[model samples]
Target: MWSVVLLWLSCVPAGLQAAAVYRRDVPHQKVEVYSVTLDCTVTSRFAHTVMTSKALNKANSSQEIFFDVDLPKTAFITNFSMEIDGQLYVGNVKEKEKAKKQYDKAVSSGQTAGLVKASGRKMEKFSVSVNIAALSSVVFTLTYEELLQRKLGHYEILTRVKPQQLVQEFKIVVNIFEPQGLAFVEAEASFLTNDLLLLVDKTVTDKKAHISFTPTLEQQRTCPGCEGSIIDGDFIIKYDVKREKSLGEIQISNGYFVHFFAPPDLPRVPVNVVFVIDRSGSMSGIKMQQTKEALKAIFDDLHEEDHFALIIFDNKIIKWRKYLSKATQQNITAAQSFVKRIKDNGSTDVNSALQEAVKMLKNGHRKNTIPERSTDMIILLTDGNPNSGESSIPVIQKNIQAAIAGNMSLFCLGFGNDVDYSFLDVMARENLGLARRIFEGSDAGLQVQQLQSPLLLPGNLA
Candidate 1:
């Protein structure tokens, strides 16, 4: 029971919301947010969420407004649009470079420029500013979609709502479709807020699910000129479907189909794991301590069939083992000790360190005498940008690409807000994996364990 409690306490939802206020050239200008609306639709295999925020100018002069919002790393944005001075501007998804070029072109052509781009794992930081005439309003809308990833026999969907400022009107609606029938469904908010009113459709069916809620703020009786609302956390929903005994399930809707495959009782396969850590000076305090703790926990949980290596980098790189070693009792203990002794001091060399990790994995894959098919993966933990060696992001990206050549998957864990999450996100996507941001205040070990689940793909269930 205690272990269960600890696990739940450690593994809370991993969404962090940061707010950036628009700076007005003329100080003391007032900007009032009028409303915020959220719509989410979920199917057995996928979910789509959209947010629209409307704000109006309260100052006598024209006002400029900007909004920065974050989203989960797994989400793929589908659309972004804005209404300025009664004109609507919709942004189309394009290649990152192409999108940038389009945005630049719009600005140069004296048109309303709008852009939506991914900044980090499960997070999209978007900022758009337009000059609004006095007493005028602007509405900005963003839509994104993500796979309803399955875990522990259920499907999960998560959405974040944080409009830094309290609005006059706020609402959210969720629609879920599950032709397989829902065994159960649950929705919850992270904090207590009277503003959130959940609405459920009376026409309930085994295949249909729906929920709607509104978050608002009320004048605080205790404090003058203050408001009360839970505007900081995530809105999460999870449900399990009644499955017919089969190796997989498929759902079809409106000419689109989704397949869910879960192989049964697959034996564990051996895996080669490499830990690439960044020990820059910026990671000297609590960040380093938590990293060590996470590493220690990972070490203690390793299976004997697994082979592992550790590579730490700052201005220089150090390898715990020249080659991968079996995760025996002795080796695990040694690895734990090595993790305990890691100290932070130098500048970061992200490019070279990652290259070294991939090289080690490649060499191990070719030379290992083990007969079982072992998956090769590199877990990179960093807290800073590449500054010491091969500092250019593009150079580092191309170099790592050439080194791995699609031989191994790279998963990155960005330590704190100081790290370049965009860099990590891009690198992971290129290598057939993903990146995650470890909020400095959360349990780093839990985040590490979350990523560990992907290691247990049905084909490599260990």
Candidate 2:
């Protein structure tokens, strides 16, 4: 009988231990309570979550419990601590933004959205601790937000995620939607792919999305026999996409389009050109007259931002203006008048002319020293060879090189065959510029055309 009593006493302790554990039952989920009652919304644009309840129940009643709540995936609760009836529960609460199925449909249909959209999740939870209690309730809240889609015209998209609790594994899914009858132009998920230009036919679809098309070289329809005829044409184009992803179906009816045109965008660089003209005896008649006309045309082509200085070289380099000035009507007229007054001189000292031009450019560089507007250029025109004062090719080349290194572009114009083409070529090549050989007759205008062509081309040399 005594042995039986001892066994009963041992069983009593086990029963008491089980009875000591307590759990509190909450009717509503903690997230629901916080969102509805406390009016707390997740503020993160991405996925985020927070727990709203931190209570314990030590009652001795056994009961069923239910958790309910409407939680967004963008909640911003940084940390969460919870205990049920003095016992911490090992669990987690989370929220996530759902991806749209329409996006995937759009990609398949060839109506891809230019912007990239991503998805994210945030969650917080705790383990239940052992303590005195009855029935207990554990409440959690989850929220998440989808990543933004890539912007229109952007070639690539990237997304990232961080979970509140460390997880063993995870999976992500992206769907892309395409317009009906839309063809895949090109796509790249990894950064290691070459970007390809895509062209869409205007007749293929009536969608209003941006399109890219290779510019077609239209036929030179203008009469080739006509003098001074400028030929030009454009190529038809449609929308273009460089990268690819399976984010979701994109809708074509939504007007997500791509467009392109010929010759791409061209960047214009401001120019500060000094016109150094030779008015020596050789440039007296037709040469001088043609030079005046060419100068006028050049002045007309000057952009409002371009700066110019006119210098006439004969017995000496005479600056019509002491400094560079805007190509305004007043300044252009003044320059033209000065050119008209110039008379045929006795000698052609090209070296002195060049030195004076360099001096002007150097002074200008030191004055209005803006960062990108520092480009300087010299357009040197001559009919006769260098006649005096350091006239050797080597000496001239050395001076030209120094000016170029100081950010000056040199263009040499050889009027008539009497002018040395060899020297002109060397000067131009050294500065990555151009050299034009003008014939004696009416075709001299061709030299001006040649000079203007290089100026229009896109490059730092211009």
Candidate 3:
């Protein structure tokens, strides 16, 4: 199943006869967005919703109208639809290849329809564009689904708000119904201001919540005369549910059952981690320097109860030590120094690098130096696809999975624009871990440090 959610649906569809009602707010703008609404309903923490945005081309001639929205990266859009005036166009979603083919065929006549591209650190951009005759309106709707996972004892719902222009009527509403009873619920936005704060609302009962953020046209302006939108960041809702002490919570409904489990805090099990660093030529200047800084910060945060190893590689592998070293002050400093010495040279050998990292952990565990209860993982950082030494993606995935043998997790970080993010994403998924693309920027070090939020992967499941 794919992850999907409807973002806005506050405006009713009954009376949309006038293009004047759809105002973009910016005078002389070719298109007028009359209404924008996101309505999300969650039952037992499973959300079902859609976002609806309406725009009318008020120009004297045909003009290109675009509907753009940022979506959570984890959500998979299973179905998408667009209404151009009175014509309803429905599209099916399945395997990526098939779905893409359908999309290509729909707009084969050369008119634009939809485009989904990777956007931010945790969100993707879903865009739709159509050429509408003067006075015609367009309605865009997207459907996607994702199973929300608990992180740091709470579930978060994130929606990216980027309507491109100031909308006359804009609102987002989320309704949550939890049968087991809600522990707490809170909502906030990155663009919230004094006046916008008043528009944000949260009503939570033991078993339900109604959260909404509806800023008026005046409240969305940057200044008295500015027509630009102030709503261009993340809208987040965080909440959790009460859990029982047993095997978590299980509910039976309509002859089906769902088991939800996340036990309370348990004693920390020491982690055995191996840092697989890539120093290919592409990671020459800023990337290398930022990576070293990130590694130093990472060492500063390691728990003393944990053990770690370092493996830096391009075409060749270099080990920091013979085996895992305890995260003591002295060892962390030495590891930091080792990271600082990594320079850019040679071609990438991801396959060989990962194999050595896995072997080091497996060997340590076999030698009994690594505690049996400790969680083991490999964090592979690369800035480009392998251009040397077994560059085959499928072969690399197969070899790495076989070497790890489900005994540990593998999290991959792909850096820069040229990196093969999809390969890393698929590999990480197959290995019970996940992958994230680290955009190349001055804040790349902070991006690396932010990888700390990977939950349950290295935790002891109760």
| 1-462: candidate 1 lDDT, tens digit per residue | 000000001111122111122242333238877788888887775788898898888888766677555666556567777776576666654433344465555445444444334444345555556666777777888888876656776777776776655678877788888767778877776753453423322234788888776544552111335653446677777787776556566777789555665455666667788899888897887679878867876776678888889999999999998988989999998988888889998898988888888878777756754324777888888874888978988788888878878877888888864568888888887886788766554456755666666653425321
Positional deviation of residue 219's Cα in model 1 after best superposition, in angstroms: 21
Candidate 3 accuracy as TM-score = 0.65
lDDT (Cα, tens digit) per residue for candidate 3, span 204-235 = 98899999988778778888879888988889
If both were scored by TM-score, which would come out higher, candidate 2 or candidate 3? 3
lDDT top scorer: 3
The regions of model 1 sitting more than 4 angstroms off are 1-39, 43-152, 156-172, 177-199, 202-208, 212-237, 241-260, 369-371, 456-462
lDDT for each candidate structure: 0.68, 0.45, 0.74
Q: How many clashes (backbone atoms < 3 Å, residues ≥3 apart in a chain or on different chains) does model 2 have?
A: 93
Least accurate 10 contiguous residues by lDDT in model 1: 1-10
lDDT of 2 by residue, 25-44 (tens): 43322211111111112111
Which order, best to worst by TM-score? 3, 1, 2
Judging by TM-score against the true structure, name the best candidate.
3
Model 1 pairs in collision: 71-122, 71-123, 71-124, 72-122, 72-123, 73-121, 73-122
Off by over 4 Å in 3: 1-26, 29-31, 41-50, 59-133, 138-171, 177-181, 186-236, 249-261, 282-297, 366-368, 440-462
Deviation of model 1 at 250, angstroms: 9.8
